[model samples]
Structure formats: structure tokens, C-alpha cells
Target: MLIHRIFQVVTVIDCVVGMMASGFIVSVGSTDWMRRRKLPACDRILICLCSSRLLLQGTILHATLFPELTQWNVVRGHSVLLVLASTACLWFAACLSVFYCLKIATFTQPCFLLMKLRISAMVPQLLLGSALISLVSSLPFLWVDYSSHLCNSTRSHLKNISFESPTGNNISYFKGFVMYVTWAVVPLLFFIASSTLLIASLWKHIKQMRQNATGFKDSKTEAHITAIKSLISFLMLYICSFIAEILLGIPSCQAMSRWKHNICSLLIAVCPSVHSILLVLLNVRLKLAVKSILLYMKCHRKQDSAEALWQERKSMSSS
Candidate 1:
């Protein structure tokens, strides 16, 4: 019970932080898009990714804060939507990685050149396709037997923090495994392929640049390094989340008694939260926006302090 309470608090804090970060990204991107009257393809993907993350974390927050929401009918619907949001997030990430690779990776293949030329134009279709795939993956929940297998809340100990159980209904281990394979795993594979290609291209470019007599890093090298860092971080966090989700989807695991499975859910909750902040930092536009915001806050605080000090001195002189 104590461990459950602790994990619950941690999960809540993680969700809150994630929501704030995701919200910041959405606000910044929306503001830029509206001001410019145009949206870049990369910005489009990032905004969509953050939006999906917002929905995903919000749903988790709703379930955790309101335990009774996991009762029966509500839980099944929530579970369906939750998985959908997660799948969308995964797909969006894959799209983002692919976009970065195509835009940054130096490739001479005819297919690669063709994709690079058209990737920007294809973003909208890619996003739509990802959403459709997620919808398809989620359809199984609606088809499953919710009356008996899913609605049985009696088996749940911790308001059923995990979506599925062993009975294989609205929620089962076998179904969860299948969904992960069909939905999450596919995007992960795509992401890996793109990231690998990007890395190889970056390495080759760096080696060529180093061969120059100067032997000094230039803007291109720095850009390559940054891209590699961003891609590596994304890969690491995504893999952590993938593993965590598989643990949470297990049916037989008791969240209360089995800290392993329970903690994995917490990991899943934390991933988006942590990664949202990371994305903001690694992105040039987002990073600049954050710096300006921080500067403004600092100046505002100083102005407030100066005003308070003036008022205090005036009062003293009057006295």
C-alpha cells in the first residue's frame, strides 16, 4: 500500500510535468504558425507529436487521479482511447525521425533523393496515415468482449492501473502483445532504420570535413553532432517507453504486489514528460523561444524587485 501510494504520487507528478511541457510546445508552435501564416513540415510534426503526448498524459492523469474511473464501462473506452493516443505518439515520432533523416542525411541513392525532395510535401499525408493506423490498431478494443473479460473490475487491486489483464477482452495480455507488435513496434522499426541511415551519413560527412587542412569543426559538423544527439536521445527514450509499455500491458501482473510491472507504468508515464523537455532543448526554434521566455521572466522579476524597493524607501522617508 505504501509503495502504491508512492508510485501513484510519482506518476501524478510525472504527468503534471509532461502536461506542462507538452502544453508549452503546443503554445509556442501555434503562436509561430499563426504569426507566420505558414507552418514548416518539421514544426507540423512536432506540434502533432506534442498534441498526442498531451492527450496521452491527460488520459493517464484522469485514470490515476480518479480510481473509480477504472470501474467497468468507463475503463474500456478510456483504455481504447489511451492506446490510440499512444500509438499516434509512436507514429508521430517515427515520422519526425524520418523527416530529420531525409532532410539532414546526405544520401545519393535515387530513392533517397526522391524522398528528400518530397518529404516536406508528404508530411500531412504521413500524419493522416499515422492516425488511420492508430485507429485501426485501436479498433480491436471495441471488438473485444467487454461484458465479461474487460468489465470484471473485481480482479483489479489498484483500480486496474494497467489496461489489460490475463483473461485476453477489452484488456488482455495477449491482445496487448499483439497491439504493440502491430502498432508500436512498426514505428519503432521505422525510427531505427531512419536513425541508422542518418547516423551513417553524418559520420561520413564528418570524416570528409576532418580531412580538410583546418581540422576544425564548422557549422555543418556542429549541426551533424546536434542532430545525432537529438536522434540518440529520442531513440533511447522511445526504447525505454516501448519496454515499459510491454510490462504495463501484462495481464497477470498485480500492480500493488508486483512493483516491477507497476514501476513500468510509471516509466511509461515519465517518458513523454522527460522527452517533451528534451525535444524543446534540442530543437533550435524551441530552444530560442525558451531562452527568450526565460530572459523576459528574469527582467520582469528584476523590475518587480526594484519597484518594491522604491516603495519601501519612499515609506521610510515619509516616516
Candidate 2:
């Protein structure tokens, strides 16, 4: 029980960090949108990604803090929304990876060139389609018996989660399996493909750059290297979290001991927080924002310390 509580605290902390990081992404995109009255293609996709992830984190926070509320009728609706949000997060992430691949990868293939040329125009449609697909995938759950399947415990990590039909109904389990494929596996495949292409393109570009007479890495080479590094890290993080989520949502896994279940849940919760922070560090503008914020905070703390020192000196002199 002590371990369970500790795990819950850790999960709560993860959700809070995820929420803050996601909120930062949303604020950055929203500020740019409001200021310019227009959003760039990447920011548009990012906004959608953050929004869905924010929803995912918020729902997790609610469940983590209020595990006992899982039995409530209203929790069913929230669970369904959580599934939709989680699905949308996966889709938007796949779209973002594809977008990055198109923007940065140099491929002479006609299809690749055509996609690169048109990806900006396709961003809006892709965003809409992602949400629509997630909605359609999640609609079947509205009719399923929520209590029998979704409200499995006092633990909220998997509350209202997808890909698990109620136990003993082979047909429902089949439905759950299909939804899981559509919701997660498909996006994972898409992401893997995009990352592979992007990495290959970067490697080829670096090899060519090395052959240049300058014999020094240029800015473009550095940029490509940075992107490749980011993509690889993101890819690994995402794949691990994806596997953890699959384990968490499995019906058989639910019968496992509490500590094992909590461990899996913690693994699933890490992706949003870590990925959002990675995005901040990877984007030039967002990195600047973070640096400025940190600098200001440091200055403010120094000012407070100086003021306290002066007050102490004055009090000593007075004595």
C-alpha cells in the first residue's frame, strides 16, 4: 500500500510536468498565432499535438488524484474522451514526424519531391483528419458497458482506457484489438517509416558534406545532425512508451500485482513530459523562450537575495 501511494505520487508528478510542458507549447503557438493572426505549418501541427497531449495529461491527472471516482457514471464519458485524446496524440505525432521528414529530408524521388512541395498545404487537412479519425475510432466505446470493462479498479491509470473490451467476450476483445491497431499500431508504423527516411537522408547528406573540399562540417550539416539526433531520441522514447501503453491496456495485465501495474503506468506517463521538453529544446524559437525565462528567473532570485542581504546589514547596524 505504501508503494502504491508512492507510485501514485510519482504519477501525479509526471502528469503535472506533462501538463506544464504541454501548456508551454500551446502558449507559444497561441501567442504566435494571435500576434501574427496566422500560424505556420509546423506550429499548426504542434498546436494540435499539444492540445491533444494536454487533454491526455489532464485526464490522467484527474484519474490519478481521484482514483475512487472511477466508478462514477460521468467518469465513463471522461474515459472515452481520454481515449480519443490519446489516439489523437499518436496521430498528430505521426503527422509531425512526417512533416519533419518532408521538410528536412532531401530526396530526388518524384513522389518525395511532390510531397515536400505540398506538405505545407496539406497540414491543415491532416490535422482535421487526425481528429476525425480518432473520433471515429473511439465512438464504438459509447455503447460498451463501461462498468464491466473500463472501471477496473481504484487505480486510474487505465481508467476509461482503450483496446480492452470487457473480459470474457471474445467479440468485444476483438473489437478492442481492432481499435488498438487503428489507435496506436498504425501510428507507430507511420512514425517508424518517417524516422527511417529522415535518418537515411541525413546520413547521406552528412557523407556528402564530409567529401566537400572544406573538410569541415557546415551549418546545414550541423542542422541535419541535430535533427537526426532529435528524431532518434524521440523515436526511442515514443516506442518505449507505446509498448508500455500496450501493456497497460491489456486485460490480462490487469490481473498482475499492484506494483507491476503501477510500474507500467509510470512508463506510459513519461512520454508526454519528456517529449514536450524535447520539443522546446529542439526548436530555436522555443529554446530562446526557455532561456529568456530562465535568465529572468535567475535575475529575480539574485535581486531577492541582494535585498535580503541589505536588510540584514541594516538590522545589524541598527542593533
Candidate 3:
């Protein structure tokens, strides 16, 4: 048990760091040339999506490491905030998937205009889906507030919960199951389906390039193709992690196995962490942007030091 808890803690830390890094990359990358004014909607969507990931990971980390500390008022408040953030992230991912499908599969003559006008349509769906999932996941906590010291859903003592209404436990469990289905299972299936189509499209595209190497050797097309492939690989990992989570969630399996929860949590953490690694590799522009930021910071520090020395000299002369 101690070993398992240690593994869970390590995995949670990895996931939190990965999510934060990915969010920063996405946030910074969005301001670069990859997203022009014409594509600002997509930028906004991606930024929100990445930001949600950070929040979700933060919640999970707190649940895993600081369950006891949650007894504090601030921890309790943060727990609720993390849950909301996770639900919002799920909704955003769903919207992103659907948006890609529309752009790739059903490109109409006025698709850009339609995208611009109907982008707002996705906001309500995201809001509604997130709210429903949050309500479901959090319903169980209503019956028991464990002083925020234990990880989320870490406690097994049902009797200590003082506010157990007759149906609350059942409702809570049901809500949790629903969130597992909606956020993890359903989206996973969608990712698999969409990714399958993307892979097929990429295969056909590559075949065409092979047959007409001279005509299709444009650098932009090659780069776009590579980006698509990277995205599909990331989606595949997401699907695998989700499937692992679903398998671990089986009632019989969880009941029979003491280590199931930690194992599943570790598997789930692998997705975002692996994704962070890939984003660093695939996004050349992001890599350069980070280098530039570091360079700028170094130069700014030197300038600050120079200014301080000049200020001292002027002050001494004035005296």
C-alpha cells in the first residue's frame, strides 16, 4: 500500500508538471504566427482547452497528496474549483474534436464564415456539459466533508459522513459513474473514431505525395502533414489512457483489487504527461519561442543590473 501510494504521488506530480508546461506552451504558442487574426477563434479554443488541463491536474494532485489538508476552508474551496476546471476542460476537448471534424470532413463554401458565426454555438454546449459533469462528480462529497485532509475519493469510511440523506450515497456514486462515462469513456470513443479518420486521410495524403513527389513536395504541406500525424498520435494516447481508466473502474475489478485505484490513476496521468513531451517535440515554433523568452529574460536581467549601477553612481554624485 505504501509503495502504491508513493507511485500515485509520483505520477500525480508528473501529471501536474506536464499539464502546467503544456498550458504555458499552448498559451505562448497561440500568440505566435500559427494563429493569425483569422484563426483567433481556434486560438481562444485551444488556450481554454490547455488551461482547463492545468486546473484538472491541480485538482487531482490535491486529491492525491493533500487530502488531509483539504479540511481547511481554502482547500475545500480549491477542490470545488478544480472539479469545475476539469469539467470545463472535458467540454472544451469535445468541442475541439468536433471543430476539427467540421474543418476536415465537411468544408462548405462558406465554412470560414460559418465557423466565425457559429463558434459561439459551442460555448453553451461546453458550459452545459461541464456543469452537468461537475454536479455529478461532486454530489458524493456533499454527504461527507473529510476536513479536506484526504485525497479526493480516498476515504472509505461511510459512517463518519454526518449528512447522509437516504438517497445521497446512491446519487453520489451514480453521478461519479456518469462523469467517468461522459468525460473519460465517451470522449475517448470519439477520439478513437476521429483519429482513425485522420490516420486514413494522412495515409492517402502520403500515398499521393509518393506518387507525385515533385508536385507535392511543398514544405508547408509536409509540415502540416507532420502536425496532423502528431495530433493523431496524441489522441491515440488519450484513448489508451481512457480505456485503461474504464477497465480499472469496473466494480468487480475495483472491489477485488486493492491497488486498482492507484494503478488507474497512474495510467490516467500518463496521457497528459506523454502529451507534454510530444508537444515539446512536435511544435518547433514553440521551442524557438521558449528559447527566445529565455534569451530575453537574460538580457533583461543584465540591463536591470546596468541600470542599478548607473543609478548608484548618479546618487553618489548628487550627494
Candidate 4:
């Protein structure tokens, strides 16, 4: 019981931090859009990605931390909605990866050049298409008979398990498998493909620069390194999240100790939030914005302390 409580506290902290980072992205992007009356393509994508992640993290916290409240039929019916938010977050992040690859990678091929030229114009359309795809993919979940397999052997052993059984009827299993593949596996493939291409392009560029006697101590080289690091970090987190999700769905995992289940849930919740913080760190403008906000808060705090001290001194003298 103590271990379970510790895990729950850790999960809550992870969710809170993730929500704050994602919320920062949304706030900064929206503020910029409002001031300029237009948002860059990348900022637009960031906004969508952060918004989706925020919603996803919020729902995950509510569902995980308070399973009893979510057990109502009406709340359970909205399982598809949670799936929709998660799908959107995954697709948007994948889209952002592709956007970075197209924008930053230098490819001399006509097709690659053409895509680089047109990607800005295509961002809105791509986002819309992703949204439509997420919606379509999630809709099938609504038709899934969640109540049909309530007495499944795996779930019977678990306390407060929310996911429907994927080992039930042949039809339900097939649908669940399809949904899992489309929602999780496909987006991961896209992210991996984009990250690979970006890394290859950056490596080739770095090599050519090195051959030209330009040592690798320049801003562009540093940027390339940062981007590569960011991609690697995101991939690592995504893999962890993927494995956790898979394990959570397994019957064996359902029978695990409460602390083990809590740890799995914590990993699942960490992915979106941590990835958003990485995004902020990798992006120059976002990094600057976060720094500025922190500096402002620090200065304000000092000013408040100074004022309090002055008031105390003045009161002591008068007395």
C-alpha cells in the first residue's frame, strides 16, 4: 500500500509537469498568434500538438488517478473521446517530425526540393488531414461493445482496469487489434521514418562541411546536433510509452501487483509531457520564451521580498 501511494504521487507529479509544459506551448503560441495576427506554420503545428497533449494528459490523470469516478457508464462511454485525444497527440507529433525533416534537411533531389518548397503551404492541409484520420480511426472504438466482456478472466483479477479486453470474441479482438495498430504502430512508424531521414540528411551535411575544411564548431552544426539529440530523446520516450501501452493491454500485466501497474501507468503518462518539454528546449524561440518567463518570475519574487523587508524595517523604526 505504501509503495502504491508513492507511485501515485510520482504519477501525479509527472502529469502536473507535463500539463505545465504543454500549457506553456499553447499559451506562447496563442499569444504570438494574437499579437502578429498570423502564426508561422511551425507555430501552428506546435499549438495543435501542445493542445492535443494537454487534453490527453488531463484525461489520463483523471482516468488513472480516479478510476472510481470514471466507472460510470456515461464516463465509460467517452473512452473513444480519450482515444481521439491520444490519437491526435500522436499524429500531430508525427506531423511535427515530418515538418522538421522537410524544413531542415537539405536534399538536392527535385522531389525533395519540391516538397521543401511546398511544405509551408501544405501544413494546414496536412493538419486537417491528420485530424480527419484520427477521427476516423477513433470512431470504430465507439462501436466496440465495452460491456460485452466484463467478465473476462484477465479483468476479473485486476482492480479498476479500464481498457476493454482484446482477447474476447474474434470480432472484438480483430477490431481492437486494428485500432491498436492504426492508433499506435502506424504513427510510430511515421515518426521513426522522419527522424531517420532527418538524421541522415544532417550527417551528410556535416560531412560535406567537414570536407570543406569547415570544422564543426558553427551555429548550424550545433543546431543539427541539437535536433538529432531531440529526435533521439523523443524516440526513446516513444518506445517506452509504446511498450507500456502494450504491457497494459496484456492479460499477464493485468494480474500484476498494484505497484507494478502504477509504474506502467506512470511511464504511459510521462511520454507526452516530457516530449513537449523537449520540443521547447529544441526550438530556439520557445526556449527563449520560457527563459524570459522564468527571469521575470525571479525578478518579481526578489522585488516582493525586498519590499517586505523594507516594510518590516520601517515598522520597527517607528515602534
TM-score of each: 0.87, 0.85, 0.67, 0.86
Best-fitting candidate, scored by TM-score:
1
Q: Which tens-of-lDDT digit does each residue in 260-281 have in candidate 2?
A: 6788778767887888888888
TM-score, ranked from best to worst: 1, 4, 2, 3
Model 2 lDDT-worst window of ten: 162-171
- Candidate achieving higher lDDT, 3 or 4: 4
Best by lDDT: 1
- Cα lDDT of model 3 by residue, 1-319, tens digit: 6897798768777887777676776777566535564434444566666766776676667667764542335544554565466456555665665555544432234854576457556655554565577557654544433322222244443333532234333334335445546654565565566556555656776676688888546674566566576667777766666666566544343332546666666766667667666666676766787788899999999999999999999999999
* 2 versus 4: better TM-score goes to: 4
Of the candidates numbered 1 and 4, which has the greater lDDT value? Answer: 1
Candidate 3 segments whose C-alpha is farther than 4 A from its true place? 26-39, 68-87, 104-175, 182-184, 251-258, 297-319
lDDT of 4 by residue, 56-118 (tens): 778777776775553435444456666778778778878888988998888789998999999
Local distance difference test scores for all models? 0.82, 0.80, 0.60, 0.77
Superposed by TM-score, candidate 4 places the C-alpha of residue 236 at a distance from the truth, in angstroms, of 1.7
lDDT of 4 at 152: 35
Clashes of each: 1, 0, 12, 0
